[model samples]
Target: MSQLFSPLTLRGIQFNNRIVVSPMCQYASVDGFASDWHLVHLGSRAVGGAGLIIAEAAAISPEGRITPHDLGLWSDEHIPGLKRITNFLKANGSVPGIQLAHAGRKASHNRPWEGGKAIFPNEAEGWQTVAPSALSFAEGGPVPTALDDEGLHKIRYDFREAAERALEAGFRVVEIHAAHGYLLHQFLSPISNQRTDQYGGSFENRVRFLREIIDDVRAIWPTDFPLFVRISATDWTEGGWTPNDSVALSALLKEQGVDLIDCSSGGNVPHATIPVGPGYQVPFAEQIKREAGIPTGAVGLITSAEQAEEIIASGQADLVLLARESLRDPYFPLHAAHTLGDDRPWPVQYERAKPRG
Candidate 1:
């Protein structure tokens, strides 16, 4: 049997396969409400046979959005729209998940199609950005306000509340977005976090914020469901967050009841040189899984069935998350089953087109 199609259980959730539809930002929401666009976008992947479908980063607070159009879970009003999508995914045989994130200094940006530039607080649809430090993401870019004790308390509260909303929305898995140079990643990387308090300075202090957020969310998030953290793993710059730090962090997260570490790299710095290629980030997953003794999800350029199969078969990672590849072919898993000679069932409506044996 193809290992990629093999069932794996995490906590109380059983994923029918290792194929996961990684959260890809749609930038299609209006006032953080999921529209029909989101419904079709996510629902199609469920129909395409992904075992798990994680919706894009939903801001824990309005200001946590990466763009004005980013999805959100900051209010009860956001629940019903998301519930509709989750219901469809569940009916179609996919475990629904959502990534709760705070964009931090990365917030208030124009959509990617609109040049991806920063929209200053003074600009329309933009609000003040906040972070661990008052540093700007880029030179001459917007300098975010340094978060104070009150601000930190709010962040934890927002995450806790958002987790409750996610539960109400019918999501079974929750991934805390501590990655991609965002708020939590900013706190983790010394390059971005230059504070002198308990939430910064030493490695232990640097991880304090994220640890607190996890505790806050996990407190309310049910024990039956799995909770995951997506970490950048490596900042890809000297003196930044390293794989060693990731290993140590993963170990701590495992102790904190985190089920998996979604390992990706090089998003904390703007100019860091990343050796981008197929499975380039898999080693981080392998290292963390081995050294930290935790399950890890391998993401980044894992585009093919064979490559994904090898990652799981070789004990490199427990799950493969596809973003762009899944975008190109929503049915990649169904097609992959054929490539690996595994008879994965297709959606009955589409079975008429299934390749004859």
Candidate 2:
């Protein structure tokens, strides 16, 4: 059997294959509630035969949102809507997962369709953004308030509560969004985090906040359920978060019971010159897995069944996460099974459409 189609067991959960639906924001929600769009968007991927479908970054609090439309878990009311989607995903034979996120200084932005610009606090649909330091993501961007001690405590509490809600909503896998220049990434990158306190300076200090959050979430999250952390393995700039940092952090997260490291890179700075290409980020996943001795998920520009299969077969990463490619082909996994000559089963209703030899 192809490694790509082989089942992966993490904690007490077993994935039917190595293909995962990477979390991509739809920017289609109202008051942080999952709408029918989320149900169809996620459910279709489940139906596509992905072993795992991680829903887009769900804000831990209202202020943590990248946009007003970002899905949220800050309230009990959001549970039912998400639970509905989880049910569909489970029924469709995919493991439902969620990425809990706080966008930090990146918050209060207009959606991509609206030019993806920052919306200042005084503007409609905007609220004050917070971060490890009082800095703007880009020059002339809105300066976020540096999180105070009270703010830190509250944010930690929010993550814990959000994890609890994720369980209540029937999600079996929970990934902490520490990547792509979000709140936790803000603390991890010295370019973004310049604090003089215990939360900054040294590597240990920079990682403390994320460690605390892992502790907070794991305290409530079931032991049998897999917990993943998505991280920017490199900032792609000098003196910024590097692959070494990711390896070390992955080791620590492994010790903390994190089941996987979803390796992604960049997004911590505006001036970064990432060498983007097919499988450009796969090396990072390979390095981290080898050095940190933890399962890693390779993501970014991975669009082909052969490429994904090679990743798993070569031991570069334990899983392959698809983003834009999955968008273009919701049935990518099903089609990939055919491309790889693996007789992966199709949904009963769609079996007639399945190509035969």
Candidate 3:
């Protein structure tokens, strides 16, 4: 049997395989609700044989959305649309999951197809962005309203409410989005968190917001269900969040009931030169897993079946999450199984077309 196709259990939930559809933002939701686009986008991946399909970085609050088109779970009404998507995923043999995120100062932007500009609140299709510090991400981006203690509590409350809705939407796994220079990552890195309060100034303080959010979320999320945290294993810049910091954070998260760490890197700074290449981000996953003693998923530029097989075989990561590759070929796992001689079951409907094995 292929290691990638092998089932693995986390807490009381068992995944059918190790192939995960990495959360890729569709930037297609309307008012943060899942649309018909989401159903087909996510459902096809499940049909293509991914054991886990995580929805894109869904904002826990409207202000957390990266673009006006970003997916959201901030309100009760969002549950129905999400439930429609998750129900299909589960029916198609995938454990539906969601990544709850807040874009921080990066919020209120236009979608990538729309030039990806940061729109001002007064401008059409825009709202105010908020963050740990009052910072502007770009020259034209709005200066975020820094969160006071009261606002901080509300943010936490938003995450809790979002998690609850995710449960109602049939998500078995909830991965907290703390990577890619988002709100939580904004708080974790000293480079972005310039505050003098308990949420900044020191390493411990810089990570306080993430730790607090994890604790708050775990309080409401069920014990039987798995909780994962995705962290930027490195900011790829001097005086930024480092691999060592990720290891420490992973250890802490494990103690806080986090089952896995979805490891990725960079995006905290525009100036940082990331050495991008095939499997460019796998090393971070390896480092975090070995040192932190936590299970992790490796993503980024993982495009081929052979590449993914080696990643798991080499113990680089517990799971291989494909983003672009999965988009290009939703049946990546099926192709991979054939290429690796693992010979997994292709759907009965397509068995007649299976390569001669």
Worst 10 residues of 3 by lDDT: 133-142
Q: Give the alpha carbon lDDT tens digit for every residue of 47-100 in model 2.
A: 999999999999999999999999999999999999999999999999999999
In candidate 3, the residue pairs with backbone N, CA or C atoms under 3 Å apart (3 or more residues apart, or in different chains) clash, namely: none
Q: Worst 10-residue stretch by lDDT in candidate 2?
A: 266-275
**Tens-digit per-residue lDDT, 124-183, candidate 3:** 878888898987766545899999999899999999999999999899999999999999
Q: Write the per-residue lDDT of candidate 1 for residues 1-357, one digit (tens) a residue.
A: 999999999999999999999999999999999999999999999999999999999999999999999999999999999999999999999999999999999999999999999999988988999999999998888999999999999999999999999999999999999999999999999999999999889999999999999999999999999999999999999999999999999999999999999999878888999999989999999999999999999999999999999999999999999999999999999999999999988888998999977
Q: For residue 254, what is the lDDT in candidate 1?
A: 96
Error of 3 at 130 (Å): 0.9
| Clash tally, candidates in order | 0, 0, 0
Better structure of 1 and 3 per TM-score:
1
